[model samples]
Target chain A: MKTQHEVEQFLYRQAELLDSKQWQAWIDLFTDDGVYWMPPEPSHRTWEGMPAIFAEDKNLMRVRMGRVLHPDAWSQRPLWGTNHVVSNVVIVKSSTNEVQVRSRFHMMELRRDDVRHYAGAYTHRLKKTRGGYRIKLQRVDMTNAQAAYDYVLQVWV
Target chain B: MLQERIPDFSKFVEPDRVRKEVYTDAGVFEREMERIHETLWIYCGHESQVPKAGDYYAVQLGRQPMLMVRGPEGKVHVLYNRCPHRGNMMCGDRHGNTGEFFRCSYHAWTFHHDGRLRNIPMMESGYQGTRYGRDNPECSMKRAARVESYRGFVFASLAKDGPTLKEFLGASLVAFDDMCDRAPEGEVEIVPNCFRIIQHSNWKIFLENQLDALHPSVTHQSTGRAAHEVEKMIEKKTGKAPLSYHMLSAFATVTIDKWDNFQTINHPQGHCILTGYMGLRPKDPDTLKYEKTLIKAYGQKRMEEILGVNIHHVLIYPGLSVQSPLQQLRAVRPLGVDRTLTEIWHFRLKGAPEAIYRRSLAYYNLVNSPATVVNADDLENFWKCHQGLSSDGGDWVSFARHFGRDIEKDGVVESGPGMGTSEAPMRNQMKAWARYMGNGK
Candidate 1:
């Protein structure tokens, strides 16, 4: 069994990767069949038969990351500098080879002298592999998920 | 201050150029709300949105807060959200059932789903001879001037007299027909909620961009090129890439000159239609399965006819843009001179396979969603355009591309040969705007 300290360290490392815009490293943290999801509404319980802010499999994630990192992505021409702070970690469930962790995230993104605050709760289901623990599913429920947004949500929560 | 400074409408709009104030001036925006939006036939929610009786969806028509409700008699009614008693809004939530009647939280005034007065507290004793009475139409919730539905899509007009919804739709009714005809059951249901996005530009700017074919290659080139590279890699590695990649890659592969082949038909009422260019018919297993189902529901000949209707985007005058082929729609509501709210909704083809529905959903997510790379660039351009127009950077917005090349006959304009990149749609819209602004017919 992995100790709570070990799991917390792992979580912090993931946040560090995202904050540093380490796209390849962040992608490597996901399992072969991993899923990343952000529901359109807080009440949305499932991704099946409904729309999502983001419901990306590996291929879709690859496309998204490629677009964001591409030189010609004009929207990202002045790249966003983000700080992701993950806190209030709790182990929701644990099994012999898998665990589900819940955490609160406060992400502040700065672009072109404008700063936007994004707060969300993340539910991550991780599975222990031969190399290390990898994400099976990462579901982000943004506080303003259903509200009308002024601009595009360029990056993942 | 703005009223006196308001420029003459005729002087502001010409054949090839429009004054920037039409897009940036607060006075022009107010006049638009009063003259164009309030007088026109504005779209309400679909009937399927309120399938059950008493189900209601609150909407904004011009400056009025209204509710589209399914009455107990199974009829849809568009009524003002305000209660007649104290003018308190009856339905505060975006959508919900008010039981069989709408009850005011402030005054305990009860109304039927059709906006008739059902009951009021102490009415018999409190207003025995007062002006308030159940039979008086003024005492009940007010209704729109006209309410009509074209194939389950409801629209309401606030003006008492004008063209009927059909007359107004004219050739543009093809938008709904093309969508419903694709459904084996000849109807569609909304996919519950929609993505509500606020664009920091004039509503006209958003509408104009819908039929603008030249901007996609320039604005969305990054996303398209990225997808194309990945698509080629996947094809090299696995001998094939999914159809979704093609949807994105087409943006890059379809060069700017090729856009001229797809014609834009401009109608009299400011509505415009763009013919399809994307190859939606793939003979993949999923598509074949969907085609088989369609063939079974509709005979072979009818199925062929249904599938043969090629449409890319239909701009319905001042508000809606419908992509019938993909079952996607966007409704625009102007909030201010520089602020506009757009509701992006996608539909499911009834009696079609789940795979077909997934295709629509994929397009919705990959192309139209606020988080999408394609839409993000467009939003940035819209904001930049608004900022530039608001500044002294320019005075006139040009629509002179292929000017005087549009073939006009019976008040309908069609792009000339190899002129699909024409700005006829924008010019036609401004002409209609001028008429609606009480300048010209």
Candidate 2:
């Protein structure tokens, strides 16, 4: 029984958690079966066709988290700093236990001498938890679908 | 005076060995762009990318900017991306449809999809008898020296004469075969998108590392070991570690002995393939359903044969690597002597079960995707290798591990066995490098 404004607050809160690199806290926001997916095709639906990007469950997300913190994780040597700005929040559909939401985001990631802006649209299927809500799926559609880019850092949407 | 000692490129390399400078030299990179990237049958986007008339995708080969477009007459054409009028780029977008013809962005000059001039804006009035006109082919976008397609994959060569595209691909054409054969309908669908990573290192570093069996356990040791620990905990708690752990722990769990158990098959034309590293076949319902569907599409025997084929990685040297087991391909485009761009793309096995595709997608996300820890480990080393090579610590980065132990049978070099320490793959690639950089003796 969360209002639309409350849902928007939840979205922005997730962004803040990411921006602060609160890795484990971010992991706690997902339901057990939640999926983290980013389609290589920015405009494609993950349910309708193959997803170029997919993290099926929490264990995969944990593995990603482990790599981010692992000392041998060489790619993060000069650890990257990110600003996740999630906006355009809208509740697409809602039920007693689950709701679908859509939003747009612009993320600025600074690593070494390179600064990249990742702008995209996101679709989230969330389940209402006893405490609050848990994410079931989050899909990211990037604007630069076809351009050659730096290797992706950890997961995002 | 430094230009005077460009080091006799010929004497520095033999058929089996090459000087490290061939990999870390700026002068050599310039020569490769002209002699190899420009002369060889360089791959462009697939035909499916430009399915409709007037559709085009821009690609760069060496210093030449080119576009692969579908002409109005239903033919795929490869044209230099520059407009002949004022040398402006024809299509600024990576891909788009020009409706019927290309209109230059700088000037309003229009050309047919096949690089034939269609209009000059103010034609007869502006240039009554001038050298420029709509009928002049020179006034249009220039086509590449040669363009051809094989089973829908497009490739263009800047050189007028060399081997045909097929001849150039040689055993390397297995990149296409391994993929197309896996398709139930004899086709694969491009994901319509890609992960592009620009590594601050020489392109050779990435290519050399693709088939190198030695670095994974060391480079990804921490990720692998951490994943392994979590996997054991998960197994104790849940009776099984999710496949994601398998994706990471495989790096740590696949002992040096098991790595030696696998083998690399080196072929001519710089193409090579490593033995399969995964045991993907299982008797699960998802797999059973896929096998049944494949059996129905192909025959029972054909289905069994296709499903049971064991393969893990294929290194189509000089540029591309295909992990058919995972339905992924990484094309290496060298940006400079110390810079490289890797375009990673995943494919879906057309007509396969959605779950099967998901496994491929998971593998794609796990091992090859930029988000994956496996890729992060690999990229870090590419940079470190570049930095280390640039140092004055040593004049040569040795490819001498298990050097003489390689077995040569019918032109294929086979390395025996070792865990996380075989330099054989590097030697094989450098061997091929020597041949390509060497004059055709």
Candidate 3:
């Protein structure tokens, strides 16, 4: 049985990987068929009906990772330095091989001396793997999902 | 303030160059809001936005906060959002049903969807015959000088009299026609909400860049190259790359010199249209299925004619850019001299299959969304352009490329042979601006 402390540690490790821009390690945390979604609005319950900020499968995620890691990605010419603070972690559901965890996150991103704070709720569906845990589905709901933004939101929150 | 600081409008705008103050000076920006935006037929919202009788969408037309609502008889009305009493905004939220009447939260003053006063609390007891009557036009919300819709696309004019919306649109009316004609049902419906992005640049810079064919290779080369590599990899592994990749990789493959192959047609009203460069009609199963449906609905010959309309982007003067082929549009709202808000909205081709709608959605997310690298690159250049124009290092912004190589027939300007990369759109826009500002008229 995986304890709450184990789940918390797993989430913290994932945050560190993303914060450090460890692209390969971060992508590795997702299963072969994993999904990452960020709905465009708070009222969005499914990704099918309306457009989303991001509703990427493994292939699209790989493309996004490639763009961010590429030296020529001008938007990320100097990569955004981010610190993700994950809290209020709760295991919403659990089984022998899979778990659904919900948590709140506050991400502080800095690039070109400009800082932006993004707060949101994250719901992650994870599965136990031989090496560790792989993300089955990761859904992020940004607090300012509906607000007009000054620039492109290039990072995952 | 700008009347004294800036030179004559004739000196500021020429056929091939424009003074930097036109894009950088705050005073000039305000004047533009008064002379251009306020005097033009600015796009408000789609008719589908307010489908129901009480539904409304709050929008900004130049400096005025306005609401586009549907009345009891299913007629659309555009009115200033200010309440008659105390001048508070009536609709606070971005959009919602006003429940048959709009009631101001501050004082409970009510008005019908058509902006006629419905009731004021205790009107008979509190006050009477003191210029607060229900019949007084001043006591109700002020309507726009004129409101009209062309093919479900709504536009409002603040000027009391001018050319009708049709006259203003002129040849540019094809933007809506081409979009609606694509749908098998011969109409379109909005896909609910849109992506509102605030760009830190002069609004003109955004409009000019919409038809500028010279920068795609330099600005989006990296993203395009990356997507190209992945697309090739996918083709090797799966025998085909998705259509979404072409949407990005085209930025690289369509080199600067090749951009000349696609011509831009300049219109009298400052509107411009760019001929399509990308081959959107892929022969995949999804596309084939969609084509078959179109053939059945529109017939083989009519379907070919509908799909054969080749256009990339159409600029509707100073305020809107429509990508009819992709079923997307962007409405430009100038908030300040250096801050512009763009509302990016996509449409669903009614009666088309789910796969066709998905294609539009993919284009929306990959090319137009604020989260995409393609749009990010454009945003960066917009900011940089504004920053450079603000500095004294440059005095004149050049539109000199292929300036003398444009042919005028009737009232429309077409690029000369092999001069498709010309800055005719920018020149044409300034010409119209000069006229509107009372310099060339």
Candidate 4:
């Protein structure tokens, strides 16, 4: 079993990878069957038949990263920059090979001529392996999930 | 006395182009709200949204705040959100049940679910000699002039005198029929909640893009190319990739010139239907099971006829855009001259298999959701278009692509052969707009 300090270190490193736009490394933090979910509503428990802001598997994540990183993505023309502050980490439950974690994040994204703030809580289910801990599922509940955005969100929160 | 200068609205629209003022002018936007949005039948929420009695959903119809409430007998009524007592708006929340009756929090005035006056606080003591009484209809909340539903999708018109909803819908009624008919139970139910987006552009831009077959290739090329690359890699590795990848890659696979294979039928009422191009009928196990279920519900030939109705997108005049094949729709509500609000809602085929619903969910998340690259790029273009139009860069927005080549038969305009990229839909919409704005009907 990993200690609380080790879990905090893992989360901080994950945030660093995201802020630096390390697409592949950020994705590698997840297992092969990992799911990245941003539910449209906090009451949404599953992504099977309900509409979600994002319910991507590994393949879909790769597609999203490729599009955002592409040359002709006009939405990313001014080049988006995000700073992430992940804190309040709490290890809800830990077993021999699995751990459930809860935390809060505030991401400020700068695009073109506007800055948008996204504050959310995350619940991560991590499975321990030889290399390190890999995410099995990451559920994001955004505070402003129902806000009428000025434009479409191009990147993950 | 200062004479008001009457603007000639007809001069702003020609047979092949429209003046930019039509999109940018505040006065023109006000006129559009008065003559087009308020006068026409605008789509309200689906009937399934307020399935139980006393349940209500708040919606905006043009500049008026409205509510769709299920009455005592499961009938849906559209009412103005204002209370008759002091004009204090009732139901400040987005949606909730009013319990037994709608009681105004300001003065304790109550109204029935159908907008009828139910009771007033201390009627005998407070207003014994006053004109206000239970018999006065003005004491209750006002209602929309007309409320109608087509196969469970409700629509309301503020104008009492005009074509009925069916007459106005005309050929576009197929949008609703095609959606509900595909279900095994011959109906669809709302998947509650929606993704509401506010685009910083005129509402017309969104309706025009619904059938503008030319921009998908140019605007979304990056997304398509990226998805295609990953799809090819996945296929090489796993021998076959999932169908979800093709949902995006098709944006690239179908090049600009290839878009000509699809066509649009532009109705006189400003509605348009784009022909289907997506290959939704793969012979996979899940699909085969769906087909079997459909065949069992609607006989073999009937099921074939139902599924064979090929449609990709349908624009219902001033407000709704329905993607019937995928059971999703986007309702446009104009918030201001330069602001438009869109509610993206999806539905479930009532009795279809779970896998079928999952497919619909996948398409909703991948294509319609605000997070997807497809929607992001489209929004960027919308913003750019609005900014350019608002500037003094140019005066006329051209719709001259194959203008005179369109074939008009029995008032229905269709693109000429091999002219699928024709701007006939926009022209038709402008012509309808000119009529609506000129006559004020």
Candidate 5:
């Protein structure tokens, strides 16, 4: 079982990997079938039979990474770096090999004079693996989910 | 002299043309929020958005905060996002059920889904014989001047009087009809959550560009060209290019001159329709199954006719662009002369198969979502256009393309046959804008 400190450290590590442009490392944190989700609704969401607001298996995540890290991704030029501060961490529930954790994240990105701050919370459904732990699911719903956005969303919350 | 309500209206508007300041001036923008957006039957949302009792979706009416909520009786209501007592805004969250009714956080004033005052704390003592009693209309949350729903979409006008929603919509009603009629079940569910974009340019810029029929082949050329090359290479190696590539490649392969091939029909009150370009009725299994389901829902002949309705897009004047072929509609709310809020929403055709829904999702993500590269390119141009227009680079932005070339008959305007690159739409929209900003209602 992972302790609060251990989980916090892990979350920080994930942010560092993303901030450092360790694309492969960040990509490897998920289980083979892990799903990444971003609920588009600012309020209640019952998509009925539809899959999800955004449900991407490993393959879809890979496609996203390819587009983001691709040299031709002019949107990523100068490379925006983000600092993710995760707080209010809590272990909603824990089991033998799985844990559900909820935490708030405030991400600030800087590309020279341009800076954008994305404040949101995340719920991670994880499973204990032989090595450590693998993300089973990551669900993000931001405070500004309904706000009009600028450019492409090439970064993770 | 004209009524004092609209002073200087003559200088800002004309029958044939108007000053650019109408779009670039702050005062004019503010006046529009009052006289147009708030006074007209602006769209609220779709019925599917709030399917269950207590479900609600928040939206903007000009600069005011408003929401669309479904009551226990299954009726949709549009309400101001404010509390009646202390004036604290209700439903701080973008959307959610207020349970049976909305209870204000400041003073615990509760309101029903119909926006009727339900309870006020210590009602017996706090009110007594005061005008602040629960019976007072002021005690309850206020609704727009007029609220009505067409088919499933909701619209509200702040002015208590004017044309009815249907009357105002007129030919623009086709935006919703074309969308829901295409669905076999005769309804559509908004794909929950919209990609809202704040364009640095004026709201009019985005609206005009929607069916401009001239920018896609030029502004999106580079990205489209890149996608087209890959599509060709993939087609060479394999026998087919992924549908996603064609999604992007369409921008590149469809030349500016070829744009003239599509036809645009301009209706009264600024509504316009662009005839079909994308062939959605592929004889694939998913589409076939969806068609079969539609046939079951409606007769085969009706189903065939619905599916055969060749419409790629419908611009529902001043604020909306509906892509019926893809089951998506975008709403525009102007923030200022230079800032605009746009919500990009996709929909699920009721009774469609999972694969069919997924196809719409693919289009949503590939072309409509904020993550779309196509959007990235378009946003850049919008920003640049705003920058250019604000500068002294030029006083008049030309809507002269294909001018004096529109073929008008029976009160509708169409461009010369063969090319969609006609500026008839620009002229049509401007005509409406001028009328709205002029002396006439």
Candidate 6:
């Protein structure tokens, strides 16, 4: 069993990759069949039958990365940046090859002249492999999921 | 507050160009609420949303806070959200069951689901000599001047008199018809919640973009190209790619000039329809099953006729934009001159296969979700447009593309041959806006 400190280290490294705009490296933290879901509400348990903010597999994530990194993507022209503070790490359950971890995150995103704060609870089902932990599923429950946002959320929360 | 001089709308709104004030001025937005959104028949909500008795969905039509609630006897009523006494709002939450009757959180005044007064606390002692009583209409929650539902989709008009809901919808009624008819059960129900986005742009900018047919290639090129690249790579490796990838890639594959092949019928009522270009009828197993279900419901010939209704989008004048083919619609509620609230709602076809619903869900998430790059770029442009319009760099916003080339027949304007990118829709909308503004006091 991996220690709680070791799991925290893995999460911090993942957050570092995302903050540096290393999308591919951040995506590599996920297992091959991993899913990232951002449902509109916390009550939305599944993405199959209802609407979701994002419910992308690795393939779609790669596609999204491609768009965000593209030169002509106007929304990225001014190039937003995010600083993620991941704390309150708790290992809820663990098994030989898998563990479920929960954490609270506050991401302050800067785009153009505005700074938006997104705080959320992240529940990650991590798959333990020879190398390290890989995310099987990451569910983001945004605190302001129902807010009438000023504009589109271009990047992942 | 009254303006010293009423600005002439005729000068601001011309045939092919409208003054920037039309979009940037708060005064114009106020006039729009009075003359356009409040006066016209605005879409309230589908009957399916408030299916159970006492179930209420709060909706904002123009500036009025209203409620669309299902009464005990299965009638859906659109009433003012305010209480008749003391002007307190009846329902505070977005939507919920008010139980047997609506009991005001303040002062414990109760009313039936139909907005009729049931009883007021200490009615005999408190209101014995007052005009407030069950016999007086003022004692009850005020109802909208007109409420009508067509094929399960309800709409309400605040003004006492005007064109009926059917007349207002006109050719645009096909939006609902196309959506409901596609289902084997001939109905579509609203999926529980919606994505509410507040854009920092005028409401008209969003409406104009609905049938513009010219911005997809320019604005979404980067996102589309990226999806196309991934789709091709997947196709090369697996010999096939999912249809969801095609939904994004189509923006890149369908070049700018090819958009000219699709036509827009710009109605005088400001309603517009863009000819279908997505070619949604793929012969996959899921689609085939859905087709079989539809055939069993309606005869094969009728099913084909229903499926072959060439429509990509329908812009319902000043407030609603419907993509019936995909079973989604966006209701535009202008919050202010530069702030607009849009409710994006998707529906499930009653008798279609679950996989078919998934297809529409894919489009809803990929193309319309706030996180999607397609919508992100569009929103960026909308914000930029509003910012620029508020500046003094330009006075008029041009709608001059193919200006004189549109053919008008019996008040319906159609783009000239091979002129699908014409600005006829924007022109038609502004013409209607001018008429509505001119008619108002």
The order by descending TM-score is: 6, 4, 3, 1, 2, 5
* Clash totals in order: 0, 4, 0, 0, 7, 0
Against the true chain A, what TM-score does chain A of candidate 5 give? 0.87
Q: Write the per-residue lDDT of candidate 3 for residues B1-441, one digit (tens) a residue.
A: 644564477778988999999888887787788888988999999999999999999999888999999998999999999998999999898999999798999999999888999898999887675877787788898999999999999999999989999999998999999999989999999999689999889999999999898888887887777788888888999999878888877887888888888889999899999986458788788878888889989899999998889898899999899999889999999999999999999999999889889888988887776577678878878988998998989799999999888999987998877778899999999998888877325
lDDT of 6: 0.89
For every candidate, C-alpha RMSD to the true structure in Å: 1.9, 3.6, 1.8, 1.6, 5.0, 1.4
| Candidate with more favorable, higher DockQ: 1 or 3 | 1
Among incorrect, acceptable, medium and high, the docking class of model 4 is medium
Assess candidate 6 and give its TM-score to the true structure.
0.98
Q: Please tell me which model should have the higher lDDT, number 1 or number 4.
A: 4
- B35-112 in candidate 6: lDDT tens per residue? 888989999999999999999999999999999999989999999999888899999999999999999888888999
lDDT of 6 at A56: 87
Total clashes in model 5, counting residue pairs 3 or more apart in sequence or in different chains: 7
Error of 4 at B291 (Å): 1.6
Q: Any idea what lDDT model 3 has? A: 0.87
List candidate 5 stretches off by more than 4 Å. Answer: A1-108, A119-151, A154-157, B1-7, B13-18, B233-238, B439-441
Return the TM-score for each candidate structure.
0.96, 0.87, 0.97, 0.97, 0.81, 0.98
Regions of candidate 3 where Cα sits further than 4 Å from its true position: B1-7, B439-441
Cα displacement (Å) at residue B124, model 3 = 2.6
DockQ of candidate 1 relative to the true structure: 0.70
Interface RMSD of 5: 4.5
Q: In candidate 5, what are the lDDT values of residues B1-441, reduced to their tens digit?
A: 336656566565443455667668787788778767787788888888888888888888987899889988888888898888888998888777678778888878889988889998899997888888866899888887788998888998878889998998887788788788877778888876577777778888888899888888776665576677666766898878646567777877888788888889998688899985576777777788888888888889998888888788999877988988788888998878898878878888777788777767777766776556566656667777787777776666677777777889887899778758887887788777766766555
The candidate that achieves the highest DockQ relative to the unseen native structure: 6
lDDT string for model 1 (A35-129, tens) is: 88999877878877679888877777777888888777778876578898999889998888998999998988898878888898999899988
* Segments of candidate 4 deviating more than 4 angstroms: B1-4, B439-441
Q: What is the lDDT of residue B309 in candidate 4?
A: 89
Q: Of models 1 and 4, which has the larger TM-score?
A: 4
Candidate 3 backbone collisions, by pair: none
